[model samples]
Target chain A: MERILISGPADPRLDDFRDLNHSDSRPDLPGGKGLVVAEGPLVVGRLLESRFPVRAIVGFKNKLDSFFASFQAENSGVDLSGIPIYEVTRETLATVAGFDMHRGLLATADRVVEDSVASVLEGARTVVVLEGVGDHENIGSMFRNAAGMGVDAILFGNGCADPLYRRVVRVSMGHVLRLPFAHLEGSYTTWQRSLEELSQAGFHLVSLTPDPAAVHLEDALKGRDKVALLVGAEGPGLTEHAMRATDVRARIPMAPGTDSLNLATSAAIAFYERDRSQRT
Target chain B: MERILISGPADPRLDDFRDLNHSDSRPDLPGGKGLVVAEGPLVVGRLLESRFPVRAIVGFKNKLDSFFASFQAENSGVDLSGIPIYEVTRETLATVAGFDMHRGLLATADRVVEDSVASVLEGARTVVVLEGVGDHENIGSMFRNAAGMGVDAILFGNGCADPLYRRVVRVSMGHVLRLPFAHLEGSYTTWQRSLEELSQAGFHLVSLTPDPAAVHLEDALKGRDKVALLVGAEGPGLTEHAMRATDVRARIPMAPGTDSLNLATSAAIAFYERDRSQRT
Candidate 1:
C-alpha cells in the first residue's frame, strides 16, 4: 500500500474529502465522483468489508494503522499494496473533512451496484417492503432494523429515498452496505405484481397498519411461515391499494389516541414479533 | 370567552406567542412568558384535558371554534369563560409563532406543579425510572411509550431532562402532560434511597442492561406485580450503582451483533412485556 502523509488542508489529492456538507448531497451529478464515504472507525470497517471498491482510507496515523491491521487480518487476499492510507494530524484531518469531529477515521469507496428485486428475493424467507419512506434517517434505520431482526432483504417501492445516501448509511450504522436491498421498478401495478410473485413463492404478504380493525400482529403472525412485512412512511401509512393486496393487515396494538410509532421502530417491533414467533 | 382577532403580529397580547423558536427554549428567562404550548389538534385537545392551567388558545378561527365546541360538548368545565381564543388566519398565526407551518392550532397553559416521586408512585403497579436521560426527545418518547404501554408513572433519577420542555412535549404527543413523572433531588445516594423505598413498597426494581449474562426480560418479569423498570441513556446505559441497587438486572433478547435498541424503544418493549404477562 502507498502510505502517504497529508500535512496541509489544500492538498489536491484530498478533494474527495472536501465541502462534505453540501456537495455530498449531489452524488448523482455529472463529474460527481461520489465515493461511499464512511465516518468513524466502526462504519469505516464495514465499508472495508463491503463489496464496494475501496479507493483510499484517511485517518490519524495510529488509527489508520489499527484499521489496516484489522483489515489485513480479516481479508487475507486484500491487496492493499496500491491503496494509500493517508495520515494527518487530528486538526488537519478535521479541516479536510469540514467537520470538528471525524471520530478518527474516514474511508471512501466506489459505490456498488444495487441489486434487482428478483435478485434480493431469490432465496429469502422474509422481506420488508417499504413505500414512500422518503426520510433518509428513517430509511437507514429501517435497513439497520431489518438487518438486525433477521429480515432476509429489503424491497423499496415507490417514493423511497436512495438507500445509499450518506445520511442513510450513517444512520443505518453501515447496515446499508451489509443488507441486501433493491428498488422495485415499474408502477404500483408492477410493485403489486412483485408482491404477488413473493406470495406465489410461499411468502405471506402482511401489511402493517394502524387501522383499529386490523388483526393484532402477534395473532396474525402466529403460524406464518414465509412473511413479507410491509411498512409505509410514519404519517400517511400504507396506501389503500397496498393494504388491500396483502394477505393480512396487522397492527402493533397501541394505546388509544397516540400517534403511530416512528416508522423504523414500528417496523422493528413487527420484525421482532416475527422473529419471536419463529423461535416459539 | 373573549374572542380576540389579532390580525397583526405586533399586538402586545400576542407576545406570549412571538419568536416561539427561542422563547420556547428559555422559558424561565425574564420576559420569557413561559407557557405550556401544544401544537396540532390532538395535542391541543390533550392540553385542554390536562391539569395545567390553560391561559388561552391561538389558532385559525375555524379550528379554534371547533376545539371550543368540542370542549363544550365534553362538558369539561375548562374555565374558558375568562380565557381568550385568538383567531387569526393560518398565515398570520404562523408569523406570530415565527414559523410557516403552525399545524393550524396552538394552546398555551401555565406549567402544572410536578408531582413528587412518592406521589407519582402512589398506588403504582408498573413504573419506569430514568437516569442521565437528558435528551428531551428521548424523554418525550419515553413518556409516550410509558403511557401507551400501560406504565403507571415515570420517576426521574439524577441527570434527567425536564419532561415539560416543548420538544419533549411535542415528541411525546402531549403525553408528558398526561403521564405522571417526578424528579429526584440530591445525589446518587438519594436516588439509591428512592429505589430502596420502592423495594420496601414491594416493587421489584429491574435494571435493564445489554450484558449477555443477564436474565431475559420476559423471564425476569414473569410474575412480578409491582415492578419498576430502570432505564438509562442510550450509550452508557445504567450506572453501576443503579444496576446494583436494583433487585435484578434484565436484558432484552437481541440479535447477537447489534449493540442495543433505542432507549425509549427498549423501555416500550419491556413495558409491553410486562403488560402482556400481566394480562395473560
Candidate 2:
C-alpha cells in the first residue's frame, strides 16, 4: 500500500472526500462525478476487494494503518501500491468531511459498468428482486442479508433507492460493493415481461406477501431447485400486477392483526427458509 | 372518543406532547417524567389499546380524525371517552414538537408496572431474551419480529436499550406497546442465574451466535417445545458467560467470509425458524 503523510485538510488532493455529508446523495446522477464512497475500515477494505476501481483513500493515521495491516493479512499478494493513502489527524479529517466522522476512514471509487441481469442469473439458484423499496437503510440491510444467506444477485425493478448511495453502502456493511446487482431497464410492463422471462428460465418466482391466502414460506420454497424471492416496500407490498406475474405467493405466517415485518427482515426470513430447504 | 379542538400549540393541555425531540429520550429515568410517547397514527392507536393509562394526545385535525375513525371501526366496544384529544393545525403541531412531525400524530401514556418474566412466560412456547442490544431501532425491530413470528414475550438481560423510547415505538409499528417485556434486575451473575432458572422451567435456552461450530438454527429449534432464544448485540455478540449458561449454541448458516447478519435480522430468522418448527 502507498502511504502519504498530509498535514492539512484543505489540500486539493483530498477533494474527493470533502463535504461528504452534502455531496454524497446524488453522486451517481448525470453531471455528477459518479464516485462511490465507502466509510470505516471494514467497508473501505471491501471496496479495495470489489470490482470498482479505487481512486483514493483519506483517513486518520491510526485507522489507515490498522485497515492496511488487516487488509494485507486477509488478502495476500494483492498489490495496492498505486492507490494513494492520505494520512491526516482526526480533527483535520473531520473538518474536511464537514461532519463528525464516526467511522474515521473513507475510500472513494469510480462506479463501474453494471452487470446485466441475465449475466448475474446465469448459474444462480437464489436471488432477490425488489420493487418500490425507497429506504436506503432497508436496501442496505437487504444486501447484507442476501450476502450472508448466499443469494447470487439482486435486481431492482422500480422506485428503488440508489444501492450505491453512501448510506446504503455503510448500512450494507459494504456487501453492496461485493454483491452483483443490476437495474431492470424500462417501465412496469417491461419489468413484468422480464419476470415472465425469469419464469420461463425455470426460476420459481415467488412474491412475498402478508395475505392469508398465500402459502407458508417453507412450503413455497420446498423442493424448488431455483428461486427468485420477489419483495416490495413495507406498507404497500408487491403490487397486484407484480404478484400476478410470479409463480407463487408466500407469506411468513404472522400473528393475526399484526402488520407485516419490515421489508428487509421479511426478505431475510424468506432467504433463510430457502437456504434451509437446501440444507436439509 | 373525546375530541377537543385546540387552536394553538402553546395550549397547556398539550404539554404532554411538547418538545418531544428532546424529552422522549429518558422519560423512564428517575429525573424524567416516566412517560411513554407513541408517534404516528398506528403507534398512537396501539398506545390506546395498551395497558398503560393514556395521559393525552395531540395531532393535526385530519390525522386525529382518521385515527379515531379507524380505531373506533376496529374496536367497537372500547371506550375512549375520558382521553383528551387536542387537535391543532399542522404549523402549530410542528412548533410544539420542535420538529416537523412525519406521522402528524402523537400520544403519551404513563409507564405501567412491568410484568414479571415468569408471568409473561406462563404457558409461553417461545420468547426472546436480549443482552447488550443497545440500539433503539434494533430493539424495536426485534419486538416487531417477535410479534410477527408469534413469540410470546421479550426479556432484557443486560446492556439493552430502553424499549419504550419513542424511536423504538415508531420503528416497531407499535408492537412494543402491545408486546410484554421486562428487564432482568441486578448484575451479570444474576442474569446468568436467571438463564439457569429458565432452563429449570423447561425452556430450551438456545444462544444465537455466529460461531461456525454452533448447530444450524433449524437443527437447534426442531422439536423443542419451549424455547428461549438468547441474543446479543451485532458486534461483540453475547458474552461468553451468557452463552455458557444456555443449553445450546445456534447459528444461521452464512456465506464464507461475510460478517454476521444484523442483530434483529438474525433474531427474526431464529424466531421464524422456531415458529416454522411448530407449524409443521
Candidate 3:
C-alpha cells in the first residue's frame, strides 16, 4: 500500500478531494474526469469493490489503518496496493471536503457508463420501476431498500434525479454504486414501450397506487413468476399512460384519511412482499 | 365563519402564527407564545378537527375557502365559528413563517399535555414501540406510516424526539395531530416494564432486529392476536435490555452485505405485515 502524507489542504495531488460539495457541478465532474467523491470508510470500501475505476483515497491514518486491518485479518480479497491513500490531519480533511464531517475518509473514482434497462434486467426475477421520483433522498432510500429487500434492478422513467449526486450516494449507503439501474428513453409513451419490453420478457408489471379501487398487493402478486413493481412520485403517481400500460394497479391496503406512504416506504412494502412470497 | 382581516404581521392577535420556526422555543423569542404551529390548509384542517385547543388560524381566502368547503361538503363536524380566522396577505404569511413555502395556511394550538402510555394502549390492538429514535423526520414518518398501515398508536421508550416539533409535524403530513401517541417514562429498565405492561394487556411484544438468528418477520407474526412491534434507532438497534423483555425477536430478512433498512421503513414493513395478516 502507498501512503502519502499531506499536511495542508492546498496540495495539488489532493485536488480530487477539494471542495467536494461544489465539485459535482464542475463540467468535468465524475463522468467528465473530475472524479466522483465518496465519503467515509464504508462507501469508500464499496467504491473500491465497485466496477467504477478508483483513482485515489484521502483520509486520517487511523481510518485507513482500521480499513486496512479488515483485509489483513479477514482476507477480504480487497487490494489497495497501487492506489494512493493521502493521510491528512482532521482539520485539513475537513477543509478539503468543505465540511467538518467527511466520515473521516473520502474516495474518488471515475463513473462507469450506465447499464441499459435490458442489461440490468437480463436475469432479474424482481425489478423496481420508478417514475418522476426526482427527490434525491427518496431515490437513495429506494435504492437502499431495494438492495436490502433483494430487488434485482431499478429502471427510471422521466423526471428522475441523477443517482450519482453526492447526497443520493450518501443516503443509499453506497447501494446506488452496487445496484444495477437504467433510464428509459422518452416520456410516458415510450416508457409504456419499456413496460411492453418487460412484458415481452415475461415480467408481470404491477403499478402501486393508493386508490381503493385497485387490487390489493397480495392479490396482484398471485400467480406471477417474474414481477416488476412500478412506483411513481409521492403526490402525482404514475402517469395515466404508464398506468394504462401496466398489467394491473395494486395498492398496499391503507387506513382511512392518510396520504400515501412516502415513495421509498411504499416501494419497500412492495419489495418486502415480493421477497416474502418467493420464500413462502 | 367570521373572518377577521388582519392587515400586517405586527398585529398582536396574529402573534401565535408569527415566526413559527422559532416559536416552539419561544419562552424567549417570537410571539412569546409557546404554541405548536401547524402549517398549510391540510394540517390547519386537522388542527381545527383535533382535541387540541386552537388559539387561532391565519391563511389566504382561497385556502380557507377550500378548507371550509370540505367541512360543509363532508359534514366534518368541526365548529370554528369562535376561532379567530385571521386573513393575511401571502407576503405577510411568508414573513411570519420565515419562508415562502407556507402551503397557504397556518394554525396554532396550545400543546396538549401528552397522554399516558396506559391510555394509548387501552384500545390499541397493534402499536409501535420506539427506542432511541432521535431523528424528527424518522419519528414523523413512523407516525405517517403508523397511520397509513393501521397501527393503533405509538409509544416512545427512551431517547425519542418530540413528535410535535414543527419539522416532524410537517413531515408526518400532519398525521402527528391525527394519530395518537404516548411517551413512556424512565429509562430502558422502566421501558422494559412498559413492554411488560403491554404483554400483560395481551399485546405480543416483537422486537425488530437485523440479527440473522432472529425469527423471520412472517413467522414472528404467526398466531398472534395482538402485536406491538419494537424498533430502535437505525444503527444501534434495540438495547439488549429492551430486547430481553420482548416476547420474540423478529427480522425483515435482508440480503447479504446490506445494512439494516432505515428505521421508519423497517417499522412500516412490520406494520404492513401485521395489517395484512389481520385482514387475511
What lDDT tens digits, residue by residue, belong to model 3 across residues A1-280?
7799997988888887677777655355453334566777778878888887888888888988897777456646767678888889899978876888646888888877889888988999999988988898999999999999999999988888878877888899899999999988886567667678889899999999998999999889876899999999989988888888899999999998888888899999999999888886
How far residue A103's Cα lies from its native spot in candidate 2, in Å, is 2.1
* Preferred candidate (TM-score higher): 1 or 2: 2
Pitting candidate 1 against candidate 3, the one with the higher DockQ is: 3
Q: Considering lDDT, which of the candidate structures 1 and 3 is the better prediction for this target? A: 3
- In model 3, where do residues sit more than 4 Å from their true spots? A25-34, A71-76, B25-34, B60-76, B90-95, B98-101
* Each model's backbone clash number: 1, 0, 0
Single out the weakest 10-residue window by summed lDDT for candidate 1 chain A: A19-28
Tell me the tens digit of each residue's lDDT in model 2 across A1-280: 5688878888888888788865566654553565799999889989988999999998887787788778898887656878998988888888888888867789999888889888888898898999989999999999999999999999899788889888999999999999999887667556666786678778999999999999999889999999999999889998888899898999999989888888898999998888889987
lDDT (Cα, tens digit) per residue for candidate 3, span B1-280: 7899988877788767666667765344444555777887667777777878888888888888887777567654777768888888888878777778447878888887788888888878998999999999899999889998899999999888777888888888888888889987787567677677888899999999999999999889977898999999989999999999998999999999898998999999999999888877
DockQ of each: 0.43, 0.89, 0.87
Pick by TM-score: 2 or 3, better one: 2
True contacts kept of each: 0.26, 0.90, 0.95
Predicted structure 1, TM vs. truth: 0.89
Better of 2 and 3 by lDDT: 2
The Cα error of candidate 1 at residue A74, in Å, is 7.1
Candidate 1 error regions (>4 Å):
A7-10, A21-34, A60-79, A87-104, B7-10, B18-34, B60-77, B87-104
Strongest candidate by lDDT: 2
Q: Candidate order by DockQ, highest to lowest?
A: 2, 3, 1
Pairs that collide in candidate 3 are none
